[model samples]
Target: MFFSCKPAEMANLMEDEVFMAFTTYAAIVILKMMLMAPLTAYYRITRGSYANEEDVSRKSAEEKKKLLKAHPDVERARRCHQNDLENVIPFMLIGLLYALTGPELSAALLHFRLFAGCRIFHTISYITVLPQPSRGLSWILGMLVTFSMAYRVLSTVLLL
Candidate 1:
């Protein structure tokens, strides 16, 4: 008699909670990259300090201020993207840990979507030169999302 053989089951990362967070991370990263496109165009058209330069990261704060003074739109884009870099990273990291802890899909989606959505709106508001409270609200909302996830993870660890 011949023995029957079965193939091992392949786990789909898409179904993993951490992968959900990772996909969200990718979206945020890509969103930030797309935000830079217009910034680059503005820089090139306005001839900002680092536009033609090979090394864009060596500029001192003074040089940056000069560019800002010369091109207000570029400054807006710069600040918008810089703020994203500061905020998005922590959100992604904490979110990954939070998801791995087996947070509900709805909860994870809430955290991921709200933060990314707020970030998009935040950048849009900045680039359009919107008033303070609206832009401020977006930043606050994103912070709250990240903080909530952090609390969830921390609370879980503390209980353990």
Candidate 2:
């Protein structure tokens, strides 16, 4: 019996891509999961109904904001969480789509890294009250990643 190694092609799977896909998923999941910390802090600080009738009855977000007014840290945490949801959802979906096509290993790493690192740094900056442009730069990094992935997926390089 004999076996032969095949060249890199559509049928071939690169370890970098495969590992990045798995790690990207893990990192995304962790980022999402970590939001709970701020949420818990908000709930504790605000002392609002996190799981009780206040949640169901307070359909008006304005009401919730009013409740959290006394706790600026909590309010900031909530806003940061909202921002994360706004940006991360699209990025996560786009990242997953790109992962399936298995882009160039280096490109994949850069995109994944920028996307994850930007989000992480953005959250840190938001929580730490960093000056202007710090958060914006991180956001742009993540957006650039998504844009790059979108372009690659749409480009002639990979029809998938």
Candidate 3:
């Protein structure tokens, strides 16, 4: 007995890997969006404001001071959330590069998942009660993913 492979089948298999990577990226993005909800709620509840810039500016200095003084945890969460958003573009670029460069799709997918998980954990630790080490560890893990991806892309570009 012998086995035979078709050209169309091989092509389809190759396409699956890229599709899988894209789907994984999309899933992580959705999770990131979901994670923002709790952060937003905490901000709204403690800061008494939403994403409206005008509304935030309308608050008196006394009120702003009172909000910060009243809920330090919320302030911390807001700051952390903003930092996370700042890094999101780089993270997405890393994933996209990996997909484009035909790296180990599984590794890229795992990195994306790890980053998303670490971010959620970091947010929870920030918004709720948690030890410093635990929160710090989560933050570090998230940063590691971002940096690792950036390094991968840079190395690829430089080596060419």
Candidate 4:
């Protein structure tokens, strides 16, 4: 019975590790949101509203007629938020898997680091509007890391 519980305990530890990683990721996400808040505020101030997409599009058109320059910072903020939305799911999945199947601590750490690095690179590349290849590569790396964690979890389940 003790032996049987070992894996469960390890799995729990791994889950904790993953949770910590996710907490770090969440902090960065929050930072990104905070960074964008000012831009959003500016957009609202200049445009008289905070609605996005079709609403912003219509407002922007009307504002242009009135000779107000589009808020470039607000646009940047929108893009940053969009990028976060795109990558967050994969990060969460990987973290969850890590928690459930604590793989080698070093390997898991490496994967987490790589994923976080790639996310940062991806965001920078996006903000700078890097070449398609560079941005694509970063995104691919992030996905690969996430998939690796998932595979590890699935294999652990299979072994059980």
In terms of TM-score, the best-performing candidate is 1
* Candidate 3 lDDT over residue span 109-160, tens digit each: 7777787788777777876768899888987887898788777767766555
* Candidate 4 lDDT, 1-160, residue by residue in tens: 2125587776665457555665676566546545655756665567555444544564566674444445555565577667766776666755665655656657867777777788777767766678889878988998888888788777777655
Clashing pairs in 4: 14-99, 15-99
Please report the TM-score between candidate 1 and the true structure: 0.71
- Expressed as tens digits, the lDDT of each residue in 28-141 for candidate 1 is 656775767677576645666443343444667676555443466766777777787888888877876776566777788878888888888888798888888989999999
Those runs of model 4 whose alpha carbons end farther than 4 Å from true positions after fitting are 1-22, 33-64, 67-76
TM-score for candidate 3: 0.64
**What is the alpha-carbon lDDT for the whole of candidate 2?**
0.66
- Residue-level lDDT tens digits of model 2 in 1-160: 0123366543443454554564665477466647757665665545653434454464577766655434555656667777777777777766666766656777777777777778888877887889989998998887888888777656624435
lDDT of 4 at 92: 72
Residue-pair clashes per candidate: 0, 0, 0, 2
Ranking by TM-score: 1, 2, 3, 4
- Tell me the whole-model lDDT of each prediction, alpha carbons only: 0.72, 0.66, 0.67, 0.66
Model 1: lDDT equals: 0.72
Which runs in model 1 stand beyond 4 Å of their true positions?
Answer: 1-14, 44-69
C-alpha lDDT (0 to 100) for residue 158 of candidate 4: 63
